[model samples]
Target: MEIVGSRRKNSSFSSADDAAVVSTIPLYRSAPELEVRLDDFELYAIHRLRVLKGISDGLSRGKKPNEMENLTKELWKVNMRNSEASEVANKDIISHYVLRLVYCREEELRKWFLSMETTLFRYRFQLETTDAQRALLKEFDLPYKAVSNAEYESVKEKLNQVVRSIGQPLSSADTIYYKVPFEQVPDLVATRRVFIFKGYAYVAMNQVVSLLMTQYRSHLSKALVLTNRKWTSMILEQEKDRLTPIVEALSTSYLGPDYSQPREYGEISLKDIDQVAKSSFPLCMRHLFEKLREDHHLKHGGRMQLGLFLKGVGLKLDDALAFWKAEFSRKVGAERFDKEYAYGIRHNYGKEGKRTDYTPYSCQKIISSTPGVGDHHGCPYRHFSEENLRAALDKMGVGNRAVQDVMDKVRNRHYQLACTLTFEAIHGASCDAGINHPNQYYNDSKNILESRVRATRMVDTLMYAEV
Candidate 1:
């Protein structure tokens, strides 16, 4: 299948767009908070993605006599590993890395085997349903609005439009459409994020995308449902001598199959744009980037890292766009804006990919500070201790009683409100849930409290914005 947006290409590394790119954003580079130390979580996945071959392939190869014994042991270990990944007993920790595995490939067969590892997070899609467009489908046994289309093409075009409009202004009520595979019907599981529905299969947002799919599935029943799964029996056959599909571009700046646009930094290559040369940005942004790479070990190889980090730092998109230009030594405009900046904005604003858009602490971070040394960039609701997270909340202008209540809930693993209040303080919005949600991650440590120091900084932004 052809990748989306590969036809038209333009970049502004020489003229980076701040509204979209992280390298141009300020305070994003230095003394930043919320460094996602995905190393440990990342390290564990390398062996699985790189070394393991599908059981079918391993079977057909007929392991050399000497290697057969070890292969058997390894196969047994693979089964155990899959068990640990899927049905690890904790009902809450589903899909720990199923999509990550799927991210290595854009096919379905490899995913079929991976699906067997865990059932709790299992997910599937349907194109044509027997019921009305508004009928409800069972999701984790919860009522989620669903639609189906027997005709594929009608829906695929619709979904294509949705992804194409990346980085544009968004509304809560925009409608969408798409076409997907007929095989997806039995494939629906909780772990899958993006899927084909009718014509367009996706997993952008629960409510938003579902609405779009419902509206257009009836229109485009001729398109094919595309499932971006990592491994499949068919794909495994072609794996010999080919690079295993691993998502190279986890961010826009990195070298990935998704983003290969060359980027410029301060009149030089992005790889060459180091702290020594361009010191024009807010010290916080620059310092933060260096620290992440140096101290905390967060890699900013992707352009998204810096823009994403700055957004996390509370810089508005307008200010962010401007900061990047001044730091650059070249000129940029619409073409640059379309491909690079737009891609970053989509990731930053909760519009695309796993929605890493929440401003970390836009008042919602339950941390003492955003995130810094000694503190891993973990989910604040699940990371912080009750006592410390409470103190950080109090510092963020939360009331004394509210702090106490919030702290009590956080200690009890009530992450929604802890996440909500932090969100409310900064962004000033809310939802039905409050300090109450399941936490597959449980921690009790100073590390949680240490991260809250950045929470205090978020409160400062709320104070300024409200004033």
Candidate 2:
């Protein structure tokens, strides 16, 4: 890769200074032949890296900076307190190497790997002090560099010229700038968000992370597509033993909020299902509940989605079985219900085949999954079109303003944020937190409503006492 910012001029600097500059930038040197085998701890490092990447991705995607920063600091402090100095120090470097090995053969894998790595880099960069930042720049051999006062002064005229040409106001003196290649920051150029002169884009410091991430994502996307065409699976399979685990780790690893605890609406009986669904269930689940009630039956996908949600909301196995049987028997009689639908309901509760304790589907799973014509399984925000979703929201008593806001979020591809907004609209309160799981949305809705009820009751009691 070509280094874009702060062009290294050998003629201007002394030999010693040049050597110092070169030494600061680490090279991606190959590991020794004998050091090929990875230990169990090394394997665990991949998992740790994944966790860190997940944290970083979440921070980038709408999380409050202060909250994420504190969380990141706490994570490092915990690691240091455990005396895992080696793991703490080597994780950034070693994880990349491990991912490189795993993602080298496929375009899809490379794109995912690069996206996560870039997010990790941004998170680490944000956390570092000025000196540590310099150390990281050296450690990673990053192409971009901060502009010095002298360099800034020299480039000021050209920067102002470009700013004027683009019809944007001159940047404030406090606005720190970096010189990056124009090609690498096409998004900035396209959006007219950066000052470009010659071949470089003089990007503000605040825009650096976004610019770099976009470049990384675009570069990796293309690289992966090209690699897919040229690289064969036979070559990839040669190192499959080592690569397979990393791939598996990436797929199976989840370090987000746990939805396993039965915290929302506790001990829901078969008869109380309708009441709970109406008052506390998220829009997605509410839609499913209404459809099931209306039809007295649901498709398999809907059953799975709604079944796990009911279990999550503290519905016992016996109640769940009774609930399903009662609903389905209305259409198919008790015999058919027991023979066909009963087995699936029991399986969902871990009573039948495989006996796996299937948890509720998360927001990510729901949004990403595409529901068929008859299925009411997936996220309504993602699966439904703008017009259809708005109509659905309208029927749920959502105002035009709230529906418009949700439409804006959906247009921008912020599906989860749209769901949060929907929750706010339905509950008539600010959620004040991220909604990652359907169960979380349900729990938060119940909690918010309960709090409001308590507050109102307290006011009424005070009024009675005064009277």
Pick the TM-score winner.
Answer: 2
TM-score for each predicted model, relative to the true structure? 0.25, 0.70
Q: Pick the candidate with the highest lDDT.
A: 2
What does the lDDT read for residue 289 in candidate 1?
A: 47
lDDT of each: 0.34, 0.66
Q: In model 1, state the lDDT of residue 158.
A: 48
What's model 1's lDDT at 413?
46
Task: Mark the 10 consecutive residues where model 1 has the least summed lDDT.
Answer: 437-446
User: What is model 2's C-alpha RMSD?
Assistant: 6.2
Per-residue alpha-carbon lDDT of candidate 1 for residues 211-235, written as tens digits (9 for 90 to 100): 3333223212111122232244454
- What range of 10 consecutive residues in model 2 has the weakest lDDT sum? 5-14
Structural RMSD, model 1: 26.1
